[model samples]
Target: ADLSQKSHRYVRSEPGGPPGKDVYSLLRCRVLLGRPYLIEGNLLAPNALHDFLLCDDPTDALETVAEDWVTTGHDAFYVRGLQRSAKSERGVYNSEYIVFHAWQALPLYRVDYTLE
Candidate 1:
C-alpha cells in the first residue's frame, strides 16, 4: 500500500532546534504481506486454542481453527474494525484490531497509515 498519495501533516516542537527538524517522520502508509501454506492434520496444541494458526494459507488455517473453536470451545481472537477518530474534518480513517491471539498467526504485511 503506497501512502505517498495520502494527504498528511507533520508536527514538530523543539526547544532550541531548527524549524521542522524535531520530528522527521509523520503519517505514512505501512504494509505487511505474508504467505501461508496449507497442511492437513489434526491441530493439537496443549494451550492457546483460540490463537490464529500459523500456516501457509490463512484461509485454510482460519477454517481449521474455527472448527476447533466450535467443537472444543477454546479461546480465540476476534476481528474489530474501529474508526480512527470520532470526529474528523479531513476524511475518514479506520483501523482494525485482533482482540485475542494476535501472536498466533505469522505476520506478513501490516499496512499502517496512522496520524497523530
Candidate 2:
C-alpha cells in the first residue's frame, strides 16, 4: 500500500505553552508504511510512555517507510516516518540524513469502569 499518498492527521503536544497548561496541535502528515519488525532497539525508554527506535543510519532509517501502522482503541493510528534533517528541494532528502519518529495515543479512560 502507498501510505504516503494519504495525509494523516495526528494530535501533538505543544512543547512550550502557558505555564501549568497543556496545548496540542493537529498535524497533517504524509507517511509511508513498512514492516513492523523493521523497528530496531528496545520497546521501553528511560521515561517515555511509548516505544520507538532510531535506525542504525540514514539509509536504514529511510526503510522505516515500510513500518506497519498501529491502531489504538481510541481510533488513532500511529507509525514511523522519515524526516529530513534539513530542507531540500521538492521535499527530496538527497544526501541529507533522515530521522525516524513514531507516534502514540494517550491512555483512555472509560466512564463506566464496572462491567454490567
Candidate 3:
C-alpha cells in the first residue's frame, strides 16, 4: 500500500501547544481505514527523536514509524527512508531517510497484526 498517501493529525501534548513538555511524547498516526499506532521515542538526545523532529533527515525517524506500523497491525508495511532535497528542512525534509534509519535501529515495542 502507498502509506505516504495517508493523512495524519498530530496529537500534541496540550490541546494547542507544541509537543514535548507535559505531553505524552507520543506520535499518534493512522492509515486511512487502517488501525492507529503510537510511536514512542525519547524527546531528548542519544535517541534520534531530536534529529527526527528537527533535521531534514529521514534516517532518524524510521524506527518510530516502523514501530507504529508493527503495533497497528501493519507489520507487512515497509518503511522506506525519508527523501532528501536541497529545499528540505525540518522533519518533513528527509522524513523517509530518518524512517529508514529508525528501522535499522529497531526500537522497542509490540505489534498486533490481528485485526480487532
Candidate 4:
C-alpha cells in the first residue's frame, strides 16, 4: 500500500449484513498518480507487526490461544477491519455461548490494488 496515498474517512453505505443494524469499520484508501485506489489494511499484533495473523485469513474456523505468549493480551490489533472475536461457537459473534466445531467459512476482506 502507498503510505503517501493513505487517507482515512467515514462513509455510509447500503446495509447488506442485516436489517436495522449499525455497522462500523475502518476504511483506508489512497489516490496515487491522480488515480483513485483502495488500500488494504492488516490485523497485526502490537508486539509483532511483521507476523501474519490467522484471524486476518479466511477459513471455516480459526483457533488461537486465549493467552498471548509474546504479548500481554490476545487483542485484535486492526488497522481498519474486524473489531472483535466472540471467543465462542460464533467465535466472532455473540450468537451462541457454544463453540462451533463444525467447519464454518468466513468471508475474506483482503483486497489489493496497484498503480500502472
Question: lDDT of each structure?
Answer: 0.30, 0.30, 0.30, 0.28
The residue ranges of model 3 lying beyond 4 angstroms of the native Cα positions read: 1-31, 38-60, 63-72, 75-88, 92-116
Candidate 4 lDDT, 40-82, residue by residue in tens: 2222323233344323322112233322233332223222222
Task: Put down candidate 1 lDDT per residue, 4-51, tens digits, no spaces.
Answer: 332223234334445544423343323222221222222233222344
TM-score of each: 0.19, 0.20, 0.16, 0.15
- Candidate 2: stretches off by over 4 Å: 1-23, 38-53, 57-116
Which numbered prediction scores highest in TM-score against the true structure? 2
Q: Candidate 2, residues 1-116: lDDT per residue as tens digits? A: 12322211223345566666555533333433232333322222222312324432222233223344334211222223224532232222221212244442222331211112
Q: Per-residue error at 111 for model 4, in Å?
A: 10
Better of 3 and 4 by lDDT: 3
Clashing pairs in 4: 60-104, 86-91, 89-98, 89-99, 89-100
